[model samples]
Target: MKKSYPFLVLVFFSSCWSYSQSIATSPYSLYGLGSLYESNFGLTAALGTAGIALPSEEFINNKNAASLVNIPANNFFFEIGGTGIQSSFEDNVRKENRNNFQFSHMAFAFPITARSAFNLSLMPYSSSSFKISGLKIPIIDGNNEYYYLNVIGTGGLNNLDLSYAYRLNNKLSLALSASVLFGNTTDERTYSISSSTTSIDKKVNYSGIRPILSSQYKMTSSLTFGLNVKSPTRINANKVQSVTVENGSGSSFLETDKKSDIDDFYLPLDIGVGISKSFKNKFNVTLDYEKSYWDSTNQSDMYASFSDQEKFSFGLSYQKAKTARNYFNRIKYAMGAHYDTGYLEIDNKKIDDKNLSVGVSLPLDHLSSSLYISYTYGSKGQITNSLIQENYHKLTLNLNLDGIWFVRKKLE
Candidate 1:
C-alpha cells in the first residue's frame, strides 16, 4: 500500500501555518477569548467527546494523554479531521442564518517503547469573527438616553501539545503534557453622533503555556477509569490601538498604531473524570463529567461575565467483533449525547449548550485503519428580549490510518 503518513505530515504542516480564516462566527464570540474551542479527534466527536478513558489501540485519543500508552506495539497512527457547521440565530426581533467550514485537527502518534508512547498535534484553541451594528447602549446617568455603537471583531488562538504516556503495568497508566497557547484578536468600533463619528481600532496579542496531567486505571478486565487535570494559567496580553474622529469641520487622528500594556487573561483550573466499560466483547459505553472554575478567575468582559461551568457526556457503541469474518459485522456504530452549562453569563443568563450525535466507522482493508463520519445537532442560549438563541448542525469527517513499523521485509 502507498504511504499515508506523508500525506498526514503535509496536511499537518499546512494547517500549522494557515490561520487566515476564522473558525467560529457565533455572535457570542464577541465575548471573552472569542468563544473558546475544543477540537475533537478520532472517534471522540462521534462519541460526544467522551473518550477520556478510551485506549489508543485502534485510534488516537486526544482527550486524555494516558490513553497513548495503549498504542499497539510496532504500530503508527495518523488522523486528520474537519467540520462543517450550519446555524440559525433567532431573537425576538429577527433571525439570521450562516454556514462555516474549517479544519478540526491533525495528529500523529507512535510507540516509543513497549509501554510508552508520544503524540503531537495542532488545533484551534478559540475563534471569533462577528459583527454588531447599531447596538444601543445607555450612557451612565443619561436618564434613558443612549448611544449607538457599531463593532466588528475577528481572530482567535491556537494550541500545540506535546504529550508522553507510560504504562506502569497492565492495569495502570499515567501521562503528562504541556501545551503552548498563542494568538491575537482584533476589534474595530465606531460610534456616531449627528455630525461626528469616532472610531477605535484595537488588537490584543496573547501567549501562554499550560501543563496537564492524566491517569487511567483498569479497574477490571472490562472497565476503565480515567482522570485529567489542567492547571490554571495566565496568558500575557499586549494591545495595539489607533483612534480617529471625523466631523463636518474636519477629520483628525487621535492616535496611530499605539502600543500599550493590558491586563493578562487568566484561565481557571479545569478537571475531568470518565469511565469506559465493555460488555460481552460487543458493546461499549463511556461517560464523562467535567468542571471549570471560571468564577475564580475574576475575569469580566465589557458585556459579559464568567461563572463556574459544568459539562456531561455519554456514548454507546456496538460492534460484532474486531475479527468478525463478515466485513459488515465488524463495522462500528455509535451514538452519544452531551450537555454543557456554559461559562459565559450574559444579561444575567447563562449560555448553555446541548447536543446529540450518531456515527459509523468503516474499516479500511485488513489493517486497523478506518473512516469516520458523524452528524451532530445542537443549540445554545435561549431566546429573550436581550439574548438570541442559536441552533446548529455539524458534520465531521475523520481519516484515521495505521501502519506497521520496525518490521523486517520478507519479500522485498
Candidate 2:
C-alpha cells in the first residue's frame, strides 16, 4: 500500500491540472457567481449530500467541522475526488447538450489530541461557463443593417479552508473554520452587422474571507444533531474592460480600455441544521435543512435579482456487517433526494432545482480506504417565461486514503 501512494498522488495532481480550466458548462451558470459547487466529499456524496449529523471514525465528515473531533488520535485521513456532468437544455424551440469533467476537491484531516482535530482542504467555491446568442435587431444608428449579439462567460471562484474541532464533553463538540475565496471571471460580448464585428471584454477579480461556526450534540446513542452558521462577508472586486473591432476584410484592431474598482460584493449569511439516526449499524437515515439570506444582502446584478434560498435533503443507507468475510456483505448502499428554491430570480420567475441520487462504497486495502461512486439526476429552471429547462446527469468518483502518522511505535 505504501508503494502505491506516490503513484496515486501523481495521478491526482495530473488530473487536477488537466481539468483546472473549467468545471461547469451549464448556461444557468451565467448568473451570479455561477452554479455553486457542492462541498460534500465521497462518503457524504453517497449519502445524498446529507451527512451533517452523521459521525464516522473511518471517514472525514465535512458537513460539520465539529465532527472532526471523532478522528482517532494520531490517524491521518485524506480524500481526492472528481465529477463528470452531462447536461441538456431545452426551450420552446430548441435543445442543446453540453458536458464537463473536473476535479472536485482534495482534503486531509488529522487528530491533534484525544479530543481535538484539524483539517485543510481546497475546492471550487463556484463556477461560471456559458454562451448565449440573441436574435438580430435592426441598428438604426449604424451604417450597417441588422446585427446579432453573442455573449460568453467563463471562470469561477475557489476556496481554501482551514478548520479546527474540539470535543467539549462526552456528548458535545464545537468547531471553527476560516475560508479564503478568490477568483477571476471573464465576460465577452460581440455584435456582428454587415460583415463587421465589434466586441467588449470584461474581467473581474475578487477575494474575501468568511468565518463559520459549527456544533454537534449526541442526543442519544443512536441519534445526533448538528448546526452550522456562516457569516456574511464583503468581497473586494475590481473590473477591467477592453474593446476590439474587426473590419469586413478580416482586419482587426484593439483599443486600450479602462480599469476601475467596483463596489464590494456582499455575500449573505447562511445557516443549516441536520439530524441523523442509526439503526444498530445496519441502517441509517439523515435529514438536513439549509437557508441562505440572499435578500438580506440587498444586492442585484445587471440581469438577475437575489432572493432568500432554502434547501432540503434526505438520505438513507443500508450496510451489512463489516466483520463478514464476504466482500458484498461489507458494502454500503445509499439513496437520497434534494430540493432547492434557488437564489436567482429572473424576469420575476424563481429558478428552482430538484434531484435524486444513489451510490455505493467499495472497501479497499482491508478497509483502510474506499472507492465511492454516485450518480445524480436532476433538473433546474422552467421553460416558461423565456427561461430554459436544464436536465442533467452527474457522476462522482472519490478515492479515500487513510494512514497513521506521528504515532510512536512500541519498543519491543
Candidate 3:
C-alpha cells in the first residue's frame, strides 16, 4: 500500500509532463479540433479497442465505466501506456514519411465497496498537430492561375474523467462519468502570390464538459452485454490573432495580439453497444458497434463536410489456465480488427480508416500485474486528386499493476 500511493503520484506527474511535449504528426488532423484520440486502456488496443463488454475482474476496462463494479475487492489497479508510430503519406504527386511517439493514457481504479467502484483517468481527447508546406490552391474563377498556401498547426484538447459504478444486482451494473475537456490550438497560415506574402497566426482556446452513461449486464457466467452513451456538448471558443505581410517591401505587422470570441464547437451525440462471449475456458470473443451523429452538429469545415459516422470492432483472445511450471500457460495472445466510416467528407469522398492489431500480455508475477505489448497496421484516407492517403504502423506498450490492500503479511 505504501509503495502503491507513491507510484500513482509518479504516474500522474509523468502524464502532465508528457502532455506538454505531445505532438500529432498526422496531416488529416487539420479539420475541426483535430484527430480524436482513442484511449485504448489495458489490452483493449490489442483487441482493436473492443471489449466494452469485458469485466474488470482481473484488469481495468476504461471503455465502459460500469465494468468498474467488477473490480476485485481489496485490489488497486494502475495503468500507463505510450505509442510509437511510423507513418507514410502519399498523394497523386507527392509521398513522404514521418516517425514520432506520443503518450496514450494514465489511469487508476479502486473499489469503494463490495458493489461499487471509482476510477479516474487522464488522456488526450484530440490532437491538431500538423504541417503542410506550399500547397497550391487554384483560383476559384481564374483559369490556370493559382495561389500558394502554407499552414502549421499545433496543440489539442485533453480529457480528465472521473467515473463511478455501482452494481444494482448480481447481473447488472450502472455507471456515470464526468469528462472535462480543455485545451488550445495554434494555427499559422501564410499566403503568397506573384510578389506578396501575407501571414495570419491565431490561437484558439476551447473548454467544455461532457457526461457519459454506461451499463453492463452479465447474461450468463460466460457472456456479457454493454451499452454506453455520450451526450452532445458545446465547447466555447476564443481566439487570439496576429497578422503580418511581407513582399519586396519590408515586413509589416497588420495586427497583433487581437482577441475575440469565436463560434462554439458542437460535439455530436455518440452511442455504442457491445457483446462478449467466452468459448470453453480458452477463447474469448468481443464485438462492438458505435455511431456518431456528426451531421447534427451543424459544424462546417473549409475543406470538408460532416456526416454521420459508424465504427466497428471485433476481437478474439486465447489464454490457458495457470500452470505451476510452464510459463507459457500464463501468457495471453490476442488479435483484432477495426473499421470506421469517417465523419469527414472531402470533395464528396469519404475519409475512412481501417486497422488490424495483434498483441500479447505477459504476466509480471503470480498476481494480476502484466505487461501489454501490441502492434497495429492501419491506413486512413485515399489517394485522390485532392486527398492524401496515410499508412501507419503503431507499436503500443503499457504496464498494468495490481496491488493487494488491507491484508496482513503472512510471512512476517
What are the TM-scores, per candidate, against the unseen true structure? 0.92, 0.89, 0.91
Steric overlap count per candidate: 0, 0, 0
Write model 3 residue lDDT over 8-36, tens digit each, in one string.
11111111121224445666677789888
**Candidate 1 residue 16 C-alpha distance from true site, Å:** 29
Q: lDDT (CA) for every model shown?
A: 0.84, 0.81, 0.84
Q: Predictions ranked by TM-score, top down?
A: 1, 3, 2
Residues 221-292 of candidate 2: C-alpha lDDT, one tens digit per residue: 899999999999998889888888888577565755579898778889999999999998899999999999
Give me candidate 3's TM-score against the actual structure: 0.91
Model 2, position 14: C-alpha lDDT score: 17
lDDT of 2: 0.81
